[model samples]
Target: MKIPYRGVNAINSREIDKVLILSGTFGEGHQQVANAIHEATQLSLPDVESVVFDFMALGYSYLYPLSQYVYMKGIKKFPRLYGYFFQKTRKVNSFSIKLNAVLSPGMGRTLKLIQEVQPSVVVSTFPFAAGVMSKLKQYGLINIPTVTIITDYTDHSYWIHPLTDQYIVGSNMVRQALNHQGIDDSKISDTGIPIRPKFFQAHDKIELINKFGLDPDLPTILVMGGGYGIIRDGLTTFRALNALPQSIQLIIVCGHNEKLRHQVTEEFKHSKHRIYLTGYIDYIHELMAISDIMITKPGGITTSEAMAMELPMLLYNPLPGQEQDNAQFLVHAGVAMLAENLTDLKTKLLHLLFDPKLLKKMKENTRLFSKKRSTFDALDVIVQMKRQVSIPNFSVTG
Candidate 1:
C-alpha cells in the first residue's frame, strides 16, 4: 500500500486532489469538527477535495447503532462509570491498550477505501479512526501522512498513536499534556478546536436581534443542551432561570430533542420574560451574535464556538470527563463560569445578568483565548504534509 511521492505530486497538480477525513457519529462534536475542516478546505483550497466518512459506521455498520446507543445512554444513565473509565484510560495503560485494540477494527475495509480514494493525506477527527490509522501505519500497510485532530480541550491515551505524523489540539494545556505523554513537541500544534467559519465572522447584533424578533435592548441569554439535550436537571435549571428578576430574552435550543422542546415550551408558556424555544436549527451563529451570555454544557465544539463569538459562558453540570476538563480550562482562561448545581447556576446567572463589567471582562478574555482561525490553521498543517513520507515507529510509552 505504498504511495510514491511522485504519485502524490501528480495528484496534487491535478484540477482536484483529495483529503479523506475520518469521523464518527458518537456525538456531534467529532462530526462538526470534520465538517469544519471540510468547509475550510472548500473555502481556502478549492482544488483540494475533502471527503468525510463516518468511519465507525462504515467499519461496523451492524454494531454501530447499538454502540452509539450504549455510548449516549451510558453517559446519561451512568456518568460516574463513564467518568471512571475516562480517568482510568487518560494515560497509556494496559487497559487503554486493550481497549484501543478492541476498538480498531476493519483495517482491511479502511485500507480498501484509502486505495480507492487515493487521498494525498488522511485526517482523523474521531479517536477510533486515529487508532485504526495508527495501526495501519504501524503494520506497514499504508505510507500516507496521517494527522489526528483531537476535538477536546483534554488529553487522552486513545487520541495518541505511535505512528501519527501530526497531532492538532484545541489548547496549549492539551499540547503540554501530550508532550508529557511522550509525543514529540514538534508533532503537535495547539490550533484551537476547528469550528465553522461563520463563528469567526462578525455579525450585527441589533440586526440579528431584529431578524430573530428579539428586543435589541434586552440582555439576551442563550441556553443550549448540546445536540441530544443531555443537560442534567433540565427542569430545575429552567426553574432557576425563571426566577431571575430582570427582563431578559431567553433563547433555548433543544437540539434534535423534540420532547425536550415541548417540555420547555409547556413550562415557560406563561413566563414574564420573553422565551423562544426551538429544536435543532442551522442559524446558531446568528443566535450567538445576538446573545450576551451562553448557558450550556461545555462540549468542545460549543464552547469553542462561544469563544469565537466572544459570548461569555456559564457552563452547567458538565459530565465528569472531558467536559469537566473543558469547563476547567474555560473558567481558568476567564471566559466562562462553571455551575455544579441548580442553586449555583441560578446564583451565577443572577450575577452575570446584573454585572455588566464582569461580562465585558469575559468578552475581552475571549480574544486572548480563542483561536478564531482554527480551521484555516489546521488546513495549513494538513496542506504542508502533502510531501510527508512514512514515519518510522517509535515508543509511545514514557
Candidate 2:
C-alpha cells in the first residue's frame, strides 16, 4: 500500500496520526521522555492524534519484569558491569544485529502498525528501537521518517545506527560521543530531549500554592527520589528540615511505588510539620512550580525539567552509569549538589535552607544551563528530514 503525504491519508489518517512511541518502564526517564514528546506533539498540533505505547509489554510478559530488574538492580549493585555490557556490544556482529532486528518489539510491531495507521513518520525515544529501525530502513520495509531521541547523556552501542535519519542528543558531549562512533555530524542534532513546553514558562509559587491548596506562608521542600522510590532516608530528610523552627511543608511524589508511598505517608502522619505524600501525579510541573528546593535523583528528564523551572536540585546518591554522568554534569555546572548518602543528604538540605545566598546562586546557574527552545528545534530538524525524504514520492503525486 502506497502511503501518500497529503489528501485523504494526511487528513483522515490524521485521526490516527499515531506516532508509535516505543519505551519501557525500566527507568522513569525513557517513559518521561516519551510522554513529554507525546504531550508536546498533541498540544502543539491538536488535530494530530498521538498514542504512546510500551514496547516491552507487547511481548513476553515474564521477560518484562526481568528486564526492569536487571536494569535497576544492576545499576545499584554493579553499575560498571552493566555499562560494560552495552559498551562492549554497541558494535556487535551482523548476526546479533539481525537477531535484534527480528526480536525488537518496536521493530516487529512497527511494520504491521504502519499498514494500519499509515503513519507519515515514526519517532522513537528508546534505544532498543534504534537497531530495528535501522534494519527496516535498510530493507525498505517502509520509508517513513525514523528518528531516535537519546534520553541520556552518555552514548552506548544501543543508540548507534547508520540507518538513523536523525539522532537527537542531550548535550554536545553526546553528539561528540556519537561522532566518535563514526556517525556523520550532519545526522546528529544537539536538540535536547523534548520537554513539555509548559516548563518553559515562569512558575508562580503563590499561584501554584493556591491551585494545590497549599499553605502560602509555609516554605516547601519537595522530596522525589525517583519514579520508583529509592530506600533513601526520607524520614531523616524531613526531620532535618523540620528542625528549622519555621513552618515547612513537604511533598513527596512516589511514582508507581505504592509501598514506599505508604511508608512515607505513615511517617509524615506522625510528624509535627505539614507533609503531603502522593503515589502518582499527572501535574508534576505544578508541584515543581511550588517547590522551593527539590531533593531528588538526577535523572535526565528530572534534571531537564528542574532546569526548565529554574529549581535548585539537591541530588541524593543516584545510581551509577548514565544517572551518575547526569549528576556530574549538573554539579560541574553549579546547578546542583550531590549528597553522599542519608547523612549527607540531611546536612546538604540544612545548608541550603540556612544559606539564602547559595540558593539564589544555584537558581541563576540553572537558568544559564536551561534550553527553552529545544522542542521546536528538534521538531524542525526531523520534520525537515521527513520532508526531504518524502519529497520524491510526493513529486510523483503532484
Q: Rate the local accuracy (lDDT) of all candidates.
A: 0.86, 0.71
**TM-score of structure candidate 2:** 0.83
Window of ten residues with lowest summed lDDT in model 2: 1-10
In candidate 1, list every pair of residues with a backbone clash: none
Per-residue alpha-carbon lDDT of candidate 1 for residues 1-398, written as tens digits (9 for 90 to 100): 01111222233332467888999878889988988998888898977788788888878879989999899889988989989999999999999999888888878878767766677789999998999998887787777889999998999999999999999999999999999999999999888889989899988887877788988888899999898887888677787788788889899999877877888888888898998788887788999988999999999999999999999999999998999999999999999999878888888998998899999999999999999789999999998886565332222322
The TM-score that candidate 1 achieves is 0.93
User: Candidate 2 lDDT (Cα, whole model)?
Assistant: 0.71
Instruction: Count steric clashes of candidate 1.
Output: 0
In candidate 2 the C-alpha lDDT for residue 388 amounts to 55
lDDT of 2 by residue, 129-240 (tens): 6666676777767666778888877776677777888888888888988888888998899987677777887777787788777888776788786777653454565556
Residue 269 of candidate 1: its Cα lDDT?
84
Error of 2 at 260 (Å): 0.9
What lDDT is reached at residue 326 by model 2? 84
